[model samples]
Target chain A: MYAIDIKDIKKIYKGGVEALKGISLQVKKGDFYALLGPNGAGKSTLIGIISSLVNKTSGKISVFGYDLESQLEQAKAKIGLVPQEFNFNQFEPPLQILVNQAGYYGIKRQEALIRAEKYLKQLDLWGKRDQPSRELSGGMKRRLMIARALMHEPCLLILDEPTAGVDIEVRRTMWAFLTELNKQGVTIILTTHYLEEAEMLCRNIGIIDKGCLVENTSMKSLLARLETETFIFDVDPPTHLPSSEFFSIKQVDEVTLEIELDKNQSLNKVFAELSAQGVRVNSMRNKANRLEELFIGLVEKGSKNV
Target chain B: MFNHNYFIALKSIWRKEINRFLRIWVQTLVPPVITMSLYFVIFGNLIGARIGEMNGFDYMSFIVPGLIMMSVITNSYSNVASSFFSAKFQRNVEELLVAPVPNYVIILGYIGGGVTRGLMVGFMVTCVSLFFVDLQIFNIFVLILSVICTSILFSIGGLLNAIFAKTFDDISIIPTFVLTPLTYLGGVFYSINLLPDFWQAVSHFNPVFYMINAFRYGFLGIADVSLIWSFSVIIAFIVALYTLVAVLLSKGIGIRS
Candidate 1:
């Protein structure tokens, strides 16, 4: 089942700033979908629309087939949004805030308390339950937001920049927690500037740019589309760089050469050719598939033409 | 997945509202009671003795209802306005907007908090008035209804003010310029009947006048205007303000992209 189905979704703010331009995408049930985009690429705007915080000029959205406009209450009830900004009543304790969120879902006070405790503990925040939200560290605050979203047991969780400012360790912990949640059948939609986070966590990704979707595909397909492999060959200083027809090479530093080689191009052939030229190779390794490289290529290419 | 469980949202909002006001008792509760006591002492006891026997009731008794009404108005308006503005200021409002809770629940929850503060403060002020004058609840039912309704009306008004307010200065502008002026001229300290006929007709237009008069009628069973008119005006204001707020929230007027 599709967890979130957004079709022909368009959002035009006043003064005709088209923040979403008839975007369409589907998030499969239990899938961790990442929306990747640069600043001003409309990732937050799209999340805002799906969460019903931003009004759409026209679109059709459904959560588990409940129409967002017609069956708004139902559609909204199924989805939980964790915004990029930390937004909770600071004066309220973490547990109280979570319980209050449960109340919004019409959960009974007793049940809300139970659920709040359950999620807080799961998020490793139970220890700080009675502390006001303002007292928590930045990472803890983000975790509290996650706990609040989960209190209603929502089927679809949309996190906007969940780890934007978090330390690496905290982000890893959150990633682990979210992975466990996904394993238990919660569908996740996330937007982040961190391409590695998306590359690691999401099975499918969509790249939006200038209020339009520029690319959307499964992780494997997207990486595969980049057919060329990047290789950083560690070499002893050569008198001059090799002009090889087999590879595109650039001297990155005094001792290292960066080469872009297609799959059809063989490193062995380059090594044999290098041996023939008596160029001493110190070390060599194929670069891992990094989304940052791909993202830069895509966004830079797009920006150059416009 | 979209379930329209409005009651759940309502209970959540109401709980937050109650928690917010009750948590800050010194800020929300105590100051109003002290202010009302000062009013009772200076205006009711000290001044009422010099300006005695208006509308066939003791000066202290006549001003008691007005002071209570003033407290209710200020408390109700300030409660929602400040709370909502603070949420906006702190950016916490985004959480509610994204939650499953409907906009109406958000509106009602904040307003409920305001009404709680207003009525609670009003009740305390009424009790304080009792120490200075002989208490006579001439129309207890109307007094209760008037306070409750007026509290709701101004609470809604406060929410509207918060939506329009862009800064801290914006929040105070309404209460200072509009609300304070209306209350002072609302026949709170003096009777409209004692004014010239033209000014009495003008006072009829002040919504607070009806609220205070109706509340006073509840105490003394006497009013400068018809009690029914006072009740009707407060009810009308509630309906009008609720619609405006509902429309603004549904459109995401202040809280959206």
Candidate 2:
């Protein structure tokens, strides 16, 4: 059975805004999956339905083979959701928040306490466990949310924009922790604006645009679809031209030249051609981040089709 | 899993609600006590000294039951109204909404919080009355029943109000416009016998009068209304309000998106 199964879901809001238009999704057990979409793509709405925080207009959802309609509590028991916004009581202490969330899953006080301390210490929140959450900094508060969501040690964890705003150091630390959790056989479904994070962490990927699933495939297959990449090269002789063997070159300025290289060609071929032409190469870099360019192209393409 | 987690979830929600009020005792606990103290001084002592007797009992002893019931009613309603609405406004209600707890369990836990506050305030006010009058009980069972049932009824009322409230002003509207007026006209300050015949008929329409008079009968062994009728009215309101709250919660009407 799939870790999460969403079949033909539809959500029409009160004012007749159809946020989700018959979307279907499936995630295999123990898979690190990424759901990629731009703003207003129904990612959070889907997560809300799975967590029972938002009611769906029409759909069938199951977690670990337990039907959400008939076995809601049991389905909820298997899933943990870290939402896009901070939703914990600000007056609650971090330790109390974790333990309280554990209680909702039927973990007894002693066991809950142990689990609370374990996650707090693991997430580096143990030192300030007694302080009210209002006093914690932004990064610490985000980490506290993670600890609370993991209190029950759910089999399926869903994170919606979990690292939306944080310093790179803190974000990297969270990525490492999430990676460790996934390694322990917990299925994770993540939605993020950072395309590189998805490229780094997820094995399977799905891209949604305007309530439709535009692409669903393995990470390697998605990345493999790029036919050509543009590279920027700086040359020592500003006005010198390199021999064009297989690349289409455009001079950006006296020192810079743009070249589109096909995936089948190696960088060595360009260097060889430049050497034969006596063009001195100074430095080279990609014109854009690979995944970001791909993501933008995909979203724009999907929108045009609509 | 729901059955297994029900009590645990209820316990967690109940503890959290209790902690919220206790953490702000200056606002939740002390105000009711001070308000009740002033009522005892102005209405029970100084005013009663001039009005001699009411319904064959000393004026001070006569009004004590209404004052206590008033405190219980107000505290019970306010506790649930403020706590639940604040949860909604802050988005912390998602904690419970996303959990495995059943809808009825969520309602029960919140009701427990409201009833606890009502009873605690009622008990404190009763203790405070010891200095103002030599109190006696006609029927302990009826007194306990009236206090508890009224608290439960109003707690359910508060929950309904919270569920429908979109802003802080919405929560205060009913209490200020409807509840306060009803409580004042409920025979707390004077017996319905003092009103003109037509006004007495109108006073009979006020539900608060039945609750206060039944409680007064329990204290003084005298009431303007039948004890059985009052008990039935309280029970009916409790059942109706609780059923409505349960249905609303299960439907995810206000808390869910």
**Winner by lDDT:** 2
Alpha-carbon runs more than 4 Å astray in model 1: A233-245, A267-289, A304-306, B1-4
Candidate 2 DockQ, CA atoms: 0.77
Chain B, candidate 2: TM-score: 0.96
Identify the runs in model 2 with alpha carbons over 4 angstroms from their true place: A233-245, A250-258, A272-283, B1-4
Docking class of 1: medium
Could you tell me the interface RMSD of model 2?
1.1
B191-241, model 2: which lDDT tens digit per residue? 999999999999878888889988998898988889998888888888888
**Shift of residue B17 alpha carbon in model 1, Å:** 0.9
Q: Model 1: per-residue lDDT, tens digit, B71-97?
A: 999999999999888988887787677
